[model samples]
Target: MRTCRTRAAGTAVALLLAASALTACGDDGNGAGDGAPPELEIAVGGAADQVTVPDDNPIKEALEEQVGATITSVRTPENLAAMLAAGDAPDFFRLNRTQLDLYASQGLLLDLTPYRDRLQEYIDFVGEDVFELGVIDGKPQAVVRKPAPASYVTYWIRADWLATLGLALPTTVEDFEQVLQAFTTGDPDGNGSADTYGLTGSSTAFNPFAPLWGSFGTAGPGRFYVEDGAVVNGYTDPDTPAAVEYVQRLVGSGVVDPDSFSIDFNEARDRAFQGRAGVMAAGWDAMKKQEFVDAAAAAQPGADWQQLPVMSGPAGDGYITLDPYGASFFAVPASVGEDEAKVDALIDLLNYVSTDEGNRLVSFGVEGTHYTADGDTLAALPALDEDGGYFFVYQLTGRDEETYLEVKFPDEKPFIDVAAAQPLTLVYDSLVVPPEGYTASDAERYATEQLVQFLTGAKSLADYDAFVDELTGQFRYAELIDAGAAQLDELGLTD
Candidate 1:
């Protein structure tokens, strides 16, 4: 075992001296003649139940041995700005790419560019594109956490209902409308009542209409993507209005459920589960979760929901939108830059977890205790669900989502595969940060309300131009678009 002198006084003094003081006390490992490893603080993001890691956590113990440091995990403080101002910040903390840009610009985050060689393993594991999310102005100011395999929302329909109605899977926009018409009027449920609806989904903005927008070769409103060599917001795209028109017709035709305009995601899903709707749009994870699967089975014995491909429209076929850039990132306080030993230890910790052995350890826990491995399959024991909530907190680098999901929820593999195979509208919407003076919440809320109104005939389609004008003019959406374009250009992401 290596030993080093404590630097309590020196650490406190250093903390007190820094301006915009994002500092925390931990062993710097710089004392003469002892040759000891540093003690590092890692700030994880989440609420109390989610982020807490007990002292006796075996994964933490195993990781400490690999990284050659004493690890202290802390929840990201609620009052972060005050903590930073008081020089009581954690050594490193979880943040999103947007927050990374803000802190990097304020000179409150460590630039990891100088230590690239030491962090190569981590950089390679998350891939270059994801790692670049942490880079600002050619300097790596944070570490991007690898995300799971991209998940996209797709249409799911009651296959049994289609069979009962003597209809094959819809392959085009017109075909889909025909199937929906049958589902609504043909009494596919065999109960001889007209209680069924053609479609159901959350009324939250343009999200519920992703496939419809894709049929028109565009994404949902507020999504920013490159088209014809320039960045453009999806709401302002020429194709969006046609997509809106299709939805209006669907609503006006009386095939869509009225409750869809007022319900939340779960409520809309319940409408599907309870046999009130024949179709729904949601991510596979939600649709195929064991609990939900059980709920649907319980509600209707013969309920058989299956993936429905995005129907082709005038422009072309399109898939649901996805943010290629993940939301999780890790940042070190600029104060930690002074301590080279500590910085290297942090890199070592991240690198260790990216290794196959370390990833398995953190993801599944002790092989025989939490799970059993046979070939590439892992069968979880009951103890895993009982005592392993803390394991996820240690998955700082993230796991291969597909493999992880397969191992954890084997029954959902078929649905997962179906989702993986579907086409998608890759959008970089998360990269756009709302500029100062822009109230995004209000703007998004208004847009959603107007969209719902347009869909339900509460507002006429003839006034759609006025809606766009208000969105861009009164909401300062144009400002956001301008800022987003400039930001993407600066990052070399604009095509």
Candidate 2:
């Protein structure tokens, strides 16, 4: 009888395998024996330090269960040229918009046109124009995630400081200058010393002074374009001279830090937190972060930090910088030909994570085990020995407006609702064509090196025409425009 039971169990396994094979023709839902699903490897970019992976959210398990394939992940740094050139490249990886042309020219990424129709849901979620950023030389090369509002730079101010000084928030450039002066001079902290500076900001290389330059009339460098037939480049335009002069004046008057060009993003944030800086420009998401808000509150109790709308420019225009959709995106390697099973499996895995249920799993972790949900409120679960470190794993997939609201800022419902109601607009109506003959890495390196000199008065602002001529000569903007012209023409913007 014991021997019979062992033989019977083996027979049952064989029968189940046969059944799965036959049902694979239809929606068996078990995702077994459909086809030889290829293993996929993906590389991503962004806050890698903050990402946490749970055992349950393992890429291999998720992909295998959802689509009968295995997937692995590698966090690629922003500097990925060496990796891309190597023979052992991952199956899929993320690349910046500026770098797409270089990779596509080298035949590194697969043409996604064949799969365009299937990705309609994704296209719709991230607006059409924002989606267009991923297209290179008329081919859709990548997927877009988190299409941020363009030209929208918000300044957060200490509201309690204004109230204490018996002053109102500044609306115009002149008024803003006055406010800065008051913050620096008027013992705003009641410390009886003139230790406070009017304003402090991150170094220009990371977050350029484009917004401040825009307020004076000239769009900052890298900010102008022909959107719907209007020619605009904020930095080279006429108002730029005045803006440059304004910055010079601010530095000369000692109201702004002369060493502002040396500070990094984190250091600038620390300045604000330490109650030394009065104003700064940041994204809506940054303002919503607990660290930033808490920092200001801790430094000055009852300090009401208010988000300032983008300031009006001399041209009477208000603009905000649009955040790039998915600082980067995953792309299939050219080696992965049109393998239908592998592609299907890949799509299924992506679809699973994009869904509400899967999103909650990675974002909130196992609700009863890692967290408890009370109606709409979610509370943390007791610490688990297997729990990963400080970072949350879900952020790796990318954040949507809905997911962001659920996890980060549940208390700021009114602000969140308003943001949902009034979505911010993109800044440059026309996309600045990435320069030709240069790799994305090259552009980033150039921008990183050149922005500080340009902003800090180290580069001469004399002879505005000459400066423009020199920049055009060095970067070959004309060639870039020519390369991008055909695409711009297709969009019906370039007549």
Candidate 3:
């Protein structure tokens, strides 16, 4: 989004004229006017490169009309922390869940409970769970815009290749392994060379091998929860030994490329696009993107990929790893005027952006100019030489299931339909108990580092045992169990 400092040019001009008049009176004085508009400076940050200001939704004008204030934007991620540290944060900005906790703990954020009524419409639109993500220590600190379910990862494979090789689609972990072996050795790509890999994945924080690990019924990397009234670390669990052994088998059997550990998510996409990798675990949203799916299709015609459900484990158990609970929210810093009127105006702006109309405008852009909407369907505006031009800004507010279904996978309606029909799994229900002195970012970082080491063979299988021991000892699993017991006492799972 665009960031502009909101100072009244008209007021500045008047001040300069007043200064000139004072100079003629032989009074060397500076001139200022009380009638000048109150400029509200707000800092916003996220995935958007350019912020679009609609004629009717001009924030500055809207703020002035509603609350007699002008708004300006300052863009900076670093500034959010720096300003909060000095107790002078921005009027409003985006914050990840972890950062939200840090700021909330320091009492640097405003208690948004008083203004929650103004955001009722927004709260209703995003659902209660998403809305609650902005609450900290029993206080609402921010408003979430775009929130999507976290457990949307799906395994994709070359369907035609599977058919040619006379292999059935893999549903269980054992089946997955058998298929991977065939893809690696049988020249499924028909190149007659055994240079192909069975599976590939990005090493990014989200999708890496955690889901694969989760397939073994262990909470893979970064997942922490109170089980039986105790906090159990997923990575260090006994089940992880089997998971790691599986990874080692994939690596040794040539089903997984040896260099898989070195590749990032995007690079892994390249491997898939180039026909070097035959299988991948990616988000449903990602598979819909033209760059990953369409490009791969064009690179190898008739090589349509199909999404597979999360693999079932030996016990017939399967679960997808959950991402952070909610879409990020925008927090207004205390530096902004604390009056109810100013806060109300800010809420109005947030409310507008979170609505269907506002979200479509921001995401799709200028109706016919960037995209066209036919009833419920939204299509991209004519491309500017193949560049979509910041269309994703609209999606930032919040993504409805229909929008994702339309934009990401128009052809794969059956898969989308199946996923929709499945029961909603409350993966983060237990994790949301809010651990004392714990932050989600810490868990994310720890998982990313430790998991990479394990995947790369940088850490030995025995090291896996040591890692688990160290984690449990440090985090104290028994204490976590006790905490879970106290917090989730009603669930009856801890008793």
Candidate 4:
């Protein structure tokens, strides 16, 4: 219930749908069933690499046959409102949580409440916690997909260095600090040059300093956090100062390169494997990614890296990183509001996409042509490994990471295991933009700026009170919080 806003190519996801279209929705939002046009228009957002679909798209042909819907894909439309105004509306459009809420609030979206029974199976398949995220005003208006794992993000450290220094892995913030000290001072790289630091950080991709904020119990950025029965923003949380101080100390001790504050992710990652730092303070993905591994090998041969154990603080144990809905979600145009048959048909199509057969079809394409399934392993065919990388584009929900990881990263069993054991995802509904004069963005920006100040030693935790006062006094952040809290309470989600 705050304003908003995943990792790897597959796991960390928040299907960011930039397709912005609104129309009168059909009563059912499913569309006419049997007589429905096999052809439909779908707006998909992808990497800049995603251009027009090839003339002979396997997904298009297969989905048409499977769901009796002819689907036309529109690549990267600029504005949803403009599309609607032009009278060229895609029957089913994909939108992120924010757009979904915004359009729904405007009564521009079809209510899927009637089809709850029809969608219950897929909803159950996806799990209640996540599906609940899609509900607006107690009615399901958008489909929320299962998130990919945050496995790409995990504290990775120099195992060789730890072994050389005779140090055990850190299990708590205190131990982590001590390890950083050793990495900073013990010449763990063994070059005897003392050129190495302990950890590294940057402003990109959650940064290596994420554990600092996580330990303070912030639920990612802009989340409506329930603490002591009150909604509080993590930015101004009392403990944020401690988290800030911890990072300041790390930077001050020279364990973290002060330059890290300004560099982007690639530099931080590049610095990690370049032997400039011990305890790389990045994700395990760096260890698994061939290019990164190659770089690490060239810089420091015989170096072994392993993930750091989850570090604990007074509030919780772990790091904070963005998470998202992996599967693209389709929102119905208001134009179909009265067309119950069409809406029902759309629901049927979505239901098929949720099934095991549908998943296999969309994920791997036609079995023999795209990939060969050897029991649980899916070996990609030459074509799919090349041009067909985007086959899963057809999926509207239930993008199972287990299936992908099992097939692609079969050896990294720990990734799926760790994902299963982790707590439920942390996301909030900042979808509905507040009044024209107020923006959650300003407040968030101020908070991020303050955090940066805290880390760079420009500000201290002791100044937190003045910081909070400024945020409330000058920015009027209270309005944002109250609106979110009211919405959360109305939805019975404030707990």
Candidate 5:
């Protein structure tokens, strides 16, 4: 039921491909030579760091010159819905897949399907698998930005405590449990006081022990995986209850920090910094950042925290990897399609960023000033960390993650390498959107409460069947599972 449009006339698809060529493409009355160039209002959002782009920003200037447009970078409006309703939405913006779908459904988004031939360079650069995320209702309504390399959860253990207790690095789940027991009671800190716990982590979705879950061939609850050509939610996976039982045993043994079930990731991290916990599940940046390293050193001068290899279990073992498709997407307003000049400028801008010079310009910033290149390797200058830190907001089309990481955080390379090298458990939740008439938040809350009760022994594992029944009958989880399976199949992701 889907139809495609022919490629628009006069599109400047080859403008940036040649690097030095700045010839105009689509001239719809307001062409560069005819009059003033098209003006594009691009909203910058979703970046954790607040971005302030001055009028003279080199990257912004370069993009405008290449695309033959007056690029105006602005903050994401406080009330985007209101702005869109007022018929004043920004020309381009960043949003999540859900928001993209909503806008596309409302005919507020530009359909890139008509520009498929023009977008060949970008599609080939981003790859078909990841680019598929942009398609909604069988139309390419957004541009899928290929994010940097995925970050993985890692188990950080107190190497000093192991040395003090004369214990070896744990290789298996059983060995890990024994190590936890020793760290709990053996007084590894040498303070001769009952202060330290074996493990600490955030209550994060009520499933802080991700490494443990991974050992059981699953991840935290709410993850989706394909098993034997069937889609299975992690909360109801067969291995999940067994993993929960193991957690209950750990809790009953008092090896896991009780505060872990109550605190957030930051608070859990503070416990590790304060030397109150000997092991923790965290990302490399959380455990090895200079500021955290300094904090740990200040708290316990001789403390040594190191990454522990993934522990093997009866089934298998690995850390849970972030979704490779990425969460944020780039979209253009449907209004832009009304102006051929704007459409051509937008396509030119996107195509340019995916090019070698343009990608490096936006990602690494003005070459020798922000970074230096030696053959294929790029080294960062001090300005890259200082002045160029906020430049990522301009990388609308992501960067080379491995090289970017090496250049940006050279000091953390060892930990980064370790975390990146470990085996990983892949999930497909990002690809599965629940069907209508289902309140996902309500179901998630109900599931979380049930999971917590099971872990805390408030509800016996014998009642797990009852919990699933309630989820199906009360929350309609079965409907969601079926939808997820069908959707994944349609997307060719179940394979």
Candidate 6:
């Protein structure tokens, strides 16, 4: 067994995989006696950590072993700035690309250029696109975690209900409303009760009503959109009101469950699983889980849920907003750069995970002990999930995409194909802005909230013209989209 001395207190401990199994482990077969520092503690953002971190679990021990150094974290999100001011910062941190500008201004981050050459091995492994995520203003500011899993939202409907009622998946806005009518009044579940609704929507997560915005050629629920070569808020776009009218029709006609308007996302999903609704919005990743599959199966003996094609309407091409940002990325504290040894240790640990072997270990744990595989299909041994190794990614940095796809969506080919086939589009993420003042978030808030009111008859669509005037006048809404378009132009994302 190889032993690494703890970096913090200069004590030795063995955390390597069992010597009997680790034939290709990266350690040099010597402890920290070679003058290598002990472990370097790091910070991972909630975004990246949403999926994982080593966290002193068995995975951390294994990672430390592979990199020939100890690694540790103190879970520093709540007090990171204070920690940095106190010289107690983690060696690394994770953040969105926008945050790079702020940290650079505050001198809290290490400019990653000096380390870029050193990161060539990783860049080569994952490609420049993943590496570019770390770059802002033409310099690398952080290590961006890469995404490769087939995760996207689906407009899932009760296939058994559609089959039972001889209904086809709705392809246009009008068709959808008709189907919702049937779903509400047609007794599709055949349970001999009028206890069902045609459609359900949620107040959270990738915005469940986002597709309605898409049907009108608005990429998302945000205020800013491009129309006739000019940036305009959704309230100004004629189709925006049309989309609202469709929702109001559903609610006014008694096709939508009133409870869905305020229920949590999970509860809304439960409504679909319990066979109480005909159509719903779901993410592909969450839908593929065995638990969700079982939920649908229990609704009926062989009930199936399938994704509807991206529906179309009068204004734009069919499209759905795929959140441009996924939870991932990490940055080294400026303090870490002062110590050459710590920087190299950080690089070594990251470079290790960028490779296939390291990514698998980070995600699945020990081959024989944490999981077992046959013919390329791997299953986590009971202990792996029990010990929490099944959830850690060590990623906020480099990730192996192939491993992620195989592990996260082994049977998602059809689901992915449906997403790729979606039509007419609006992508509100193009207009990224902070929430507080003069931003897309504020605009989207007004738009979505008004939509809810209009559906409930608290506000009438007849007054939509006044709503448009309010948003355009109060928010400088046109200027916002113009600025966003300029940003896209600078990035060559807009013509």
Please report, in order, the local distance difference test score of every candidate based on alpha carbons: 0.79, 0.59, 0.62, 0.66, 0.79, 0.66
Reference-based lDDT, residue 445, model 6: 81
lDDT of 5 by residue, 28-96 (tens): 334353457888887757662276667787778888889989888778888776677665778878777
lDDT (tens digit, per residue) of candidate 3 on 1-495: 123323566678889999887655431111112433344445556544256533244333433464455655555456667877674565677776657767778878888787788787678778776677677768887666645554666777888889989999988889989998998889988878887888887655434454566577666644554445554556545676787777777776778866666678878877876788788877655776556667777777787688777777753556665544444566767544344445655666566656776655544445565556789877654541133343343233465656745553456666666444432333333323445764435544555677667765677777776665554455453344445445444333234
- All candidates: CA RMSD (Å): 7.0, 7.9, 9.1, 13.2, 9.3, 9.4
**Best by the TM-score measure:** 5
* Clash count, one per candidate: 0, 17, 17, 37, 0, 10
Clashes of 6: 10
Please write out the lDDT profile of model 1 over residues 1-495, one tens digit for every residue.
122234766676776777323333333343111356677777767542365578887888888888787787777788766665555678778876667777777888888878888887877888887778778878988777786555557789999999998899998999999999999999999998989989888866544566777788778677888776688787788888888888899989989887777789998888899999999888887788778889999988889999886788888766666776645677888877766777777888888888788888888888898899988788888877767777877777777776777777787777777777767656777778778889988888888788778877888888988999999999988888998898877766765
Q: State which candidate, 2 or 5, has the greater TM-score.
A: 5
- TM-score for each candidate, following the candidate numbering: 0.85, 0.75, 0.74, 0.80, 0.89, 0.78
Instruction: Write the residue-wise lDDT of candidate 4 on 145-171 in tens digits.
Output: 666655355667888888998999887
Off by over 4 Å in 5: 1-34, 53-55
User: Candidate 1 at residue 347, lDDT?
Assistant: 82
Candidates 1 and 4, the one with greater TM-score: 1
Query: Candidate 1 lDDT (Cα, whole model)?
Result: 0.79
Q: What is the lDDT of candidate 4?
A: 0.66
Q: How far is 74's C-alpha from truth in model 3 (Å)? A: 4.3
